[model samples]
Target: LDIAFIVEGSDNVGEENFNIVKKFLERVITGMNVGQEDIHVTVMQYSETVTLEYSFREIQSKESIIEKVRSIPYQGGKATNTGNALNYISKHTFTLVNGGRQDVPHLVYMVSSSPSTDVITRPPRSINVIPIGITPNANIQELRRISQPNNPIILHSYSTLIEEAPELVLQSCCSRKLWTEIPELCNKPMDVMFLLDGSSNIGASEFEEMKNFVRAFIESAEISNTSIHVSVLQYARENNLEISWNVPQETEKLVEMVHSIQQREQGPTRLGRAIDFVVQNAMSESHGGRPSASKVAIVIVSGRSEDTVEAAALSARMNRVSLFPIGVGNRYDEEQLRTLTGPSAANRIMKLQNFEDLSTMITLNSEFIKKVCMDPVRECIDEDGNKKKPGDKWTLPDQCHTVTCFPGDYTVLESHQINCERMPKPVCHSNLPAVKIEETCGCRWMCPC
Candidate 1:
């Protein structure tokens, strides 16, 4: 694994907090294998100016790497130039000459205490960036912009990072399997409903684009009765069941229905009524909603609704369904969208500038489903087939031999000594009388003799 740490050194992070950041990095280093063959590390410091303090080639061992980290003086500056830092790392550090091998997995971990001065253009997909925000101050929007979809890791403070560093190192450094694998929707069972807006606000062309987006999303996933059962509902002042989960349609049939779907002409946007209809009629037991399976509702809207959405949204939440409201274009009410999605709305709500950019939602929605649907892999399962959570004192897998050495005491009381006797009582003619008395006591102990 080739990994880089781009630590924040903005002036807001004073000398004390700067040392705390370094200490956190050191803790993470202690948990990495960090040798020539495993887990090479590069450390960078970024503030108003970006500095590559050390390159991957300089990384020799974990102990030496941690020592170098401790020696870095705080490069406190006025602004947080995260954009330049991200760009620099992508262009310069992650290269063949810098000990970055194309065959191995590469990762960038950025720790920032403040928002970036400039907008962050995402780095290449090959180098996965996990932005760790030191919270209460870290800008989440900027963090999310830099990280992979649904993959930002936020810590409450530098103090809490010690607890998360081991897992961080394990996930980023030890295994490439998780990062390389593209998540498949059919792997987990889910009940999904796509509630789309078909109203006067959306033109015919825009509606067609929306359908294309839906088609892409649907075609990407495997759909069946056992996994990812899907339904589509189109609405304006009234609602239409375009694809019903109650009627069993295989993945092929589902895609075909979306292909031939038509838009409703000249109807007002009544999003609230549509949501209520789904909660009452579409997601019921008769409509193929299995309580055992995860229930997800995605509302795609292009404009403000004609009626209130709170009551209907609350009903969906009360029923334990996760609602994701996507606001397309600039005209929709931001507050309504946020309310419909609930708290952490920024994380759940997909706000797009135009309908043409709906392809971005595929990765975002896929990642969201992967995260909210299933629990992470567990080590053990009970007889009832329930997986057990990690117990206390359970050490994480040291796949790269992160903790190879142990501290112990050694006894070595029998110390050796080296001595040089006074040269044979130098017989100087001028000081013969003074030298003669000194020469008589010339004998010295090499080891107490």
Candidate 2:
């Protein structure tokens, strides 16, 4: 769930506007409903060379992160080396690490007022690039290529149309799962159990194809040692465990071995049995000291399941396993996966129309994992800077938390890099001593600044 913001512009915004934008950005980032720890931010300004205004992962302290962003002065240059900026990000920001499970999603938000330089190079698969076209000068074609959902109509006038183009900003910065719908849900770790259809409806070949899609999607992320325990249950006419969850060390082997299965278009899709088996059997049983009573997620994949799915689904629901269904092939059981995803859960379920393109489908789901699962372990310092563990509710004016500690204005500008050239020393401002404030109404109330 690491969200990186890149501000690119040939003509940098003026200091006044820049400072305003910086403060504005601070407010926006801190005010975002996502948990502070779940939201790690990095600032990069690109002109001739991509200058790391502030390094990645350095913004852990909300206050410090704000100060660094405020310190950056906008600098404008004649040429915009967007391509180079991307390359620098790939080479320096994210490097492939062995232990990293490639599950986290990394997003780049580029506020460019112009097109990328003619220079071109290959981009990393690990990074999802999103460009915010701020004006007519912004290149539309390239922006679409970099952003998700492929096609996008570039908003040409950021200065004049920000209010009109709210969706544009959101799509570029969608860094979390259950984001728009469940804005408060933090991306945290979880124990996931996969229940796959093994009926005649989806044969061995289609199942193997599904496995590859899931693997490819999970493998192309920017996370290390990501905790993902998968117990796969295959249910066609009968339900059986093709893989187990307790053995963490041999998880990869289990995933790898799935490809060896022969696709069998078995007679019936006994999806109910598979669902019941995993939720009641696998998740409820303790393995290697890990309690089966822990939070569980059941990911079901199939074209369609049994007719008696509701009976088994009720059992799964009663057992408290969060269900997510990824429908494969044209025979998507929309009703089944939809009901299982939760009537109110954010990002409930989606069906893939084609199995041959299942890899791409899984890739889309992987984005969900990356954006919504940053704080899987879920205990982190709240915005109040108290070690209140993750998921605690400590908001503004309480302590040294970013949401309250640093509240300021922010602006999105197209300007030169202020730090790139030699400049006079800027006066340092002293930090204000924090004053104790009460959460009287549990609602924002007007108070003296």
Candidate 3:
């Protein structure tokens, strides 16, 4: 991976705060495995002038890079020329001559405390720009523009930069890894249902953003009759099945269908009812939902539901359907969103700040595919004809062996061995002796009075 840290060194970023930025860089670099062949690090500072503190070709070791980042002088100037810095990195820093490889991913961490004075255009597709905004003066709109289809990291103050360094490094590495593994991960067979909120609360423009996100997400997956089958449903007071999985269509046709969907713009967000409707109709075997395929539901909710979603969500999970609820705007009920996906809410639920941020979620297509394909639902049935889900454990009547239900293909693990050393010693009554009964792995003591 080729990573660049583009720091804003304008006059507004005082010397003391600039030192904090340097500390942030040092901490982030320390977390990554930096080497000549592994990850190439480049540092640049921009204001009215753009200066390359160090190029990828110059720094080959992690220690050298961190030291260089610590020692580089801040280029203090009046104007915050971020556009110029981005252009410079694209043209000069990431070139083959500068140690940027065509096969590896290029990522730019643009850290700024204020808005850019000049107009900024989107960077090349080859380069991913993650804009980190610090202070209230930092323009979120500008950051969003710079990092289209990817959410920008916003920090309220420069003091927290060092604290967020570990997370920064993790996000950087995971983003690159997902981009490389998406194609292979999205090849499995699955049934995907898009449950969209089309209430009056969601204006026509915001609804369009939802459609764009869905289109981009679908395009990222390998959609076919054998691979992935998709269905679209819009809900407000009523549920409208826009597209059915049974209709076998090509990728282009499916995307066009999504683009042409009109907003219902009704009243009362009946998300629970919509979920029930989807489970009964859209996910039915008659609707092209394969019995062997993994089931997934992507719920895009814009407003709080008038009805309770607990029952319907529970029903979906019981039917082996994974629910991914994406709550949009602050008005969305956080509790309801969590309930939609049950206990694993952290991994399944997504909360966007507003409707505009929905577009950024398209980048999560790979993550969604990984969730449905890699971690699928599995169950096991014991000899008594009782059903058991993954991570469940039980002991037989003899109490000699233990049974464990693991994920993937109804795997049942039985163990006859027991660790007597870890078990509590048996107590004897009336100062009687305790007899040792030998077992497969250890011995069990029997008390005799």
* Candidate of highest lDDT: 3
- lDDT per residue, candidate 3, 287-370, as tens digits? 878997888888998778999997687557656678888888888888888778765444778878876556544453355556
Provide the TM-score for each candidate, comma-separated. 0.49, 0.40, 0.60
Model 1 local distance difference test score: 0.69
How far does residue 137 in candidate 1 sit from its true spot (Å)?
1.5
Off by more than 4 A, model 2: 1-189, 217-226, 250-254, 286-289, 292-302, 364-366, 370-449
- Could you give candidate 2's per-residue lDDT for residues 72-157 as a string of tens digits? 87877777888888787667665443111135676666667677875756456557665656655776546655553322334435
Ranking by TM-score: 3, 1, 2
Worst 10 residues of 1 by lDDT: 403-412
Q: For this target, which candidate reaches the highest TM-score against the unseen true structure?
A: 3
- Give lDDT tens digits, candidate 1, residues 131-150: 87777888754675576432
Would you list the C-alpha lDDT of every candidate in the order shown?
A: 0.69, 0.52, 0.77
Error of 3 at 404 (Å): 26
lDDT of 3 at 176: 52
Candidate order, lDDT descending: 3, 1, 2
The alpha-carbon deviation from the true structure for residue 121 of candidate 1, after best TM-score superposition, in angstroms, is 1.3
